[model samples]
Target: MIKLIATFCLLALFDFTNADIQADRLYELLKTKKSRNSPVSNTWSVSDEATNEYSPVYIASQDGLSELDKIVTLPGQPSGVDFNQYSGYVTVNPNAGRALFYYFVESPTDSSTKPLVLWLNGGPGCSSMIGAMAELGPFRINSDGKSLFKNDYAWSNVANMLFLESPAGVGFSYSNTTSDYDRSGDKNTADDAYIFILNWLERFPQYKTRDFYITGESYAGHYVPQLAYTILLNNKKTNQTVVNLKGIAIGNAWIDDETSQEGMYDYWWTHAVNSDATHAAILKYCDFANETSSEMCYKVTDKAWDEMGDIDIYNLYAPICLNTGLKNASGTGSINVFDPCWQYILETYLNDTVVQKALHVKPTSWDLCSGDTDARVPITASRYSINTLNLPIETAWRPWYLNKEVGGYLEAYKGLLLITVRGAGHTVPSYQPQRALTLFSSFLGGVLPPPS
Candidate 1:
């Protein structure tokens, strides 16, 4: 979804947030007759999901991302579409008082029995547009982040890919209630996604029976499993239409904050990013070093949490990644725009036209930094973004995203094989395509080319 974060997003501070402006300029998005009520506000339209035409789904290869797919649009949608032959919808979120942009990827030539993959971006409010065109989708964009690029390793090659701008307040989707944005809890996000899928299937009835999978990264670690659980719960009730779901997967997932941070510190020491002396110092003073001042038995997780909390091993999100051989000199360099983790490889991937064309979003400014609310807030001056907290909060994706098993090797999870890049900070697809492909092959079925 964020594949377009850097490429686009010049003016996010638009009146899109103002209820008065929307009521005066466009259709009154805020209505009195609705259930998921929050304070009333007018909603925007689907066209607002993205600032431009570049969207999700991409095709990537050794030649990088290529751009040559049929331009298919959906019916029952608004006008001015590139292709009116396909199926799409403009989902107005009644709760948040806004509209979001969303679309589906039907089989290129056939609509036979197929699997569905929903690719989402993190940031809680980020757009999954790039997820459609760039990451694991069918095509990529040009250098301008506006045109199209075809991806050879697109996930659509194996299963149907669906992208969404969720939570009513994010992207081009809208809800009338401002309170909708305020209550963006795990349960709400999961429920909204479930509803979107149900409505989406209704819009494109052919995909109703497709075996579906939930896949994403970052905070989506929380999303995939949470949503899957909701589906599982719904499957238990009668008269409820069950969403045919397989398994769940996430990459570079911020599953359990406690373990992730501990893993990061260990990773830094082992990778030589920090000196043994400083590494020991962090461990000694560990931010979360103690439990009940030494004589209390907390939840077993607190032990791990305390250790990671004590050490600022994250270096303020600046772990150096040199395995790819791209170096960041002193001062701003390469992907060092914000954090220095995985700087080398991320910079290299952004330069590939194949990647660009495959994703279909041509970023005006390419950087290694996570949009991470960087454009809106002063992250440079602040210590950390909500992302840092979003990562550590204990959630459901924990057991699997850790890539290990405690009670058993795991459940009968037939979801996609998901893996997090060892050194990547954010967006593993952008930082570590090779590992992403390897895991993709392991979980799914394919021969992903090693990154060039």
Candidate 2:
């Protein structure tokens, strides 16, 4: 069951096959949307608001030149954008020639005063650019596939956002030592990411003491926590607060192997994706903690998958993009008007030579996840993982609101909080941007979401 679920979810989310399909679909969509005479405007501007009053303590810093990585502009970016953006490689292991890529976006209004957030997208091998471009980054690719539009709910609007492509093999990050790629795993990935952070701070010294938070989704469940642990261990050994590690927020993450698997099947069963007979077989024949299963367990799960049919498991109710290039035909009754083919648009835009050169990236093909929703690391998996911690509840689970509508439910544990985004799949922000932003704001503010 474990192996099956991981293979199904991870491959569906990160496999190159889906990326190719999405890219082709994007071209078809663009052909229909682009106009010859009145071209889409590339220039966009957001009015500035007053400087944010919630400021963190600042420490005096020595100047470090980061001009080499500063992005003058991105291809087709809106003119008059207020914030500074930088992207480049940070060498984590010089001896091995292992380097990781990063894209940093400063807060638009009060960058110096805002906290720093590091965002990772987890495949254990997936690139963080997915988070930057598709989820909560400052820009969204236009249908023309060569222009950009602003993401109004960009996390950078309130925090200085840092996106990383880690472990020296994902995205633009690379290692001259070929064996490093094969050896990359959780421990090494976490260590290299920590080194990347240290080296990155040297390049951008002003942020060394900034209040920092880590966030990610899916396999990042492992990346975020492991990296945070490394940071904490180093700080404890040095007896000094090195990174100013503040907090971490993981959305629909896959943290534990056992609970996540159990939760996933439970979720499928409870949500009516699997038959009761299959659920019974799983419970009777599968041993999640032991990491063993009978042949019957496999048979039952295969049956479950077949019964689930062609629906997007990530968002149970979202429309599925068909091979025929159809739109809105799945009829899943989703809450958000999610573009089933958005990944193709992103891949088309990012793979453009002009866009790569402007971002200072080497020419390489970009791939996307299979679907936009969150079933890969389902919410039920998160719930089960949290339950095992056995922490005392500080607040009862209750519905949280956005614009007077129920967004999701959240429960505050002694040292943690678990919040869900209603109608969100594996990727919360992509499915419900406004609600994700609301949850993010509440997290950074160290408060609960509005319960009223």
Candidate 3:
């Protein structure tokens, strides 16, 4: 019984009245989850055979023309920023009039030396701009809902960060063919994102040979691996390193359907969010591996939801915004802390005409994660998925620290690294920015977190 927030973009859309209906829709989607049938592997090795030739779609000369997409400055951005910012559309399918919108930020100090990390935020329908604006991006929206402040822990400090609003219907990306929207799924998303990256590299040719990594959270658990696989296959097919992909990482990911569902219920029970009887009933009646469940299973799951009450299940201990209607007021917490009402403030800022013009997006309504922290995708789900892999542990779990304070725990597997933020929720960066940044830096550096 996984309850979802309907759409992660609901907050961006500034619509809350039909949240329950959206949650129901998400639950149904989860119930009918389709198996991608893609193989799961602990290590993904790219082809060793190489060629000097580039993809037929890539043209080095197009690099100079990318200035057309350069962003001068955001509407309310702080001054003294040194990094270059760019945002615009890249046409992935000209015939279908399909284009994906992206925002690119170079590292402030070493634009040429740093690796390029492409980030996707999962909604399957949500925009990645949420990552850019609310999570690991370079700036944070101020409480005033009209200005921005620098995020000291922004990921751009160590890597050239690219955030994409993917698929045809999400965010500013679009396809003129209305039927294209109906065709959205895992395969289509991976294919379109692949094409988007190919075309994007042509625009920024300097990064063509840069070490590239894919990262995301939530449903991106699916998107990141799928896209990485696509990149590998295409590279092997062409015998060329079309995209110099290195690795991928997902946080609080929803990787496997059966394990994720089972783990969700288990997490709820262990966390004392549900009654003992409801947990027992679920364990007795639910068949998570099957496409359908017993009627008793549904009844118990619904009961579990009722027992949980109105808490932010994402970060169970975090406060819920008592005043979601304060669209213009400044939020209560600082940039490093989670502000329950920050989404409302961000909605007002992004919806501003000036901001839209600056970002080069049309005046369409923006959306945020309405169901981002839903019970459907939890940290426990990720843990279960990892267990299914059963990779050999290279390093046993140990506490990781930052500045003499315990930040999280880390464990290294034969081909995977598992790290946990002590108090983070579904969106790790939002709840623990500094710790999240340290994790990201360590991931890029291929080193363990400080054990002290």
In terms of lDDT, the best-performing candidate is: 3
- What TM-score does candidate 1 reach? 0.53
What tens digits encode model 2's per-residue C-alpha lDDT throughout 1-452? Answer: 00001111211121112332322222232222232443323111112211233222222231443687889999878777999999987777778888788999999898988999999887656777888987789887655566666788889988999999876778788888988887766778777888778778878878889888889877777778778877766665543337888888877676776787687778778878789988898898776675344567667766866777676666677776554332323222222355666666667777888878877877776555211124445666777788888989889979889899988887887778887777665666776778888888888888888998
Best by the TM-score measure: 3
Give the runs in model 3 whose Cα sits over 4 Å from its true position. Answer: 1-28, 34-64, 239-241, 327-333, 369-371, 374-376
Which portions of model 2 miss their true places by more than 4 Å?
1-65, 239-241, 323-336, 369-373
Cα lDDT of model 3 by residue, 1-452, tens digit: 11110111001011111222223434555744532343222222334313344454332234555798888889878889899999988887777888888999999998899999999987657778878887899988876778888888999999999999877788788888887887777777887888889878888889989989899877787788888877876786764337888878787776767887887788778877888889999999988887667778778888987888877766666677787665454543367665677667777887898888888877777766422453546656666777888888888978889999988777777768877777676667877788889888888887788999
Q: How many backbone clashes does candidate 2 have?
A: 4
Q: State the C-alpha lDDT per candidate.
A: 0.41, 0.69, 0.73
Model 3 TM-score, all chains together: 0.87
lDDT of 1 by residue, 370-418 (tens): 2121111111111122233333322222222223322101111121221
Model 1: weakest 10-residue lDDT segment is: 1-10
Ranking by TM-score: 3, 2, 1
Q: How far does residue 152 in candidate 3 sit from its true spot (Å)?
A: 0.3
lDDT of 2: 0.69
Better of 2 and 3 by lDDT: 3
